[model samples]
Target: MSAASEKSTGLRIVTVPVPLSGRPCEASASSLGEILALFKIGCLLKVTGNQVLAPLDGTITDIDSSQLSVKLKADNGLQLWIKVSEVSLQGHGAGCFTRVKVKDRVKAAEVLFQFNPAMLKLAGALPFARVIITNGQKIERFETTKARQCLAFEDTLFTLYV
Candidate 1:
């Protein structure tokens, strides 16, 4: 463990929310450039697993079933937007199963949704998840784990300083 892993004042820890075995990379602009441009500070995780977990303890403020996305407000007031699949898959939520609903309080590592990665691939959509800090102004800085690949609930994704 590093110094950042230790509990400290004004620091909040976020973990890998998806139970997928893949690498985390800086989010890039896709075909939906305008929409993705808003996610300047975001991470993209390659899909491998079926379940998406809560990155931190938070309440689901909004859920778009057809879009396969969830907006959560952390206990510390930080907001997050987690979206599965790319723009092409939007409104085609056939294989995606959302487990949590709006207003539901979830713990870190709680299952948020599940999807069939194979099905997404067969549909010509690259399976991935976009995790973005919606209210980034509240964060002073954040350090991402050095590891290239991370496991959900077990690996710390980012240590946020408020």
Candidate 2:
């Protein structure tokens, strides 16, 4: 068998906590139902955090202007064609919320909107990432196929299947 193949002969897929990124559970004029209807500029987003910490704590990448195949990081290619309507994260990273629109003024730590990373293909966190010991390689995954509760820095949140 090929090296990569042989190495993965007994490997298993496991899900782990990725961290819920944003929470816009507040009163707002715009409904999530409205934002999701958009398929263009207000679509697809990137976050830089895990389900164990606050979101928006890292750099953000936007895919609103570029089509999927051309506008994403190579490492993030797994997320391609996932039909992301928005990218949300909690305090610290470039966040997601209803406060976003063209030409709108925003600042760090400001509430953008309400988002529970548990709803999208991945609201970020997942409790199913496994650790396999096939050929001595560490593997972890956040599956779009299953959504479960993942712990976050002293807290726990139920991530929904998106």
Candidate 3:
């Protein structure tokens, strides 16, 4: 095994929560650095309805564009940034609702906000979901062919070694 993979360590597994409840339309396993540079997450869960739920138990750190985007600090020390819709819904945070304010403690699977992806799409916005961990890299992932597999809410998204 390569030196990186040879090092012994513990594993941290995080399951997918709601809002990302829909079937995984597309997913790409990538390094945290690459994810940051893209400004777009590798996985896009295709949701049909509007109601969005929290992916993990965390505190709301920040919100923007009238609640279309949010930053959360997961209880496990994972900082997550979520974008509800595409740029079309940027300035106009229509079809979006803010359920919790900054500093609010939320539980896993809690309702964070409600939105209508269909409306955004009608307005030329590519209605989808993107999640990323905005933190310095320390955790490493070990995934093979299953890395790109579709995921559902509550499913094991991936396993991490720390």
Candidate 1 at residue 152, lDDT?
75
Of 1 and 2, the candidate ahead on lDDT is 1
Q: Write the per-residue lDDT of candidate 2 for residues 11-48, one digit (tens) a residue.
A: 44322223333232211222322432332112112322
lDDT of each: 0.69, 0.26, 0.59
Give one digit per residue, the lDDT tens place, for model 3 in 25-141: 444421212344553223455555565567778899987744377888988887778766655354334666678888999987777777777667776665466666566276555
Give per-residue lDDT, candidate 1, residue 27. Answer: 56
Worst ten-residue run, lDDT, model 1?
A: 28-37
Comparison by TM-score, 1 against 3, better one: 1
Q: Put the candidates in lDDT order, highest first.
A: 1, 3, 2
TM-score of candidate 2 relative to the true fold: 0.22
TM-score of each model, in listed order: 0.78, 0.22, 0.70
lDDT, candidate 1, 12-51, per-residue tens: 5544343345567645633222344574456677666777
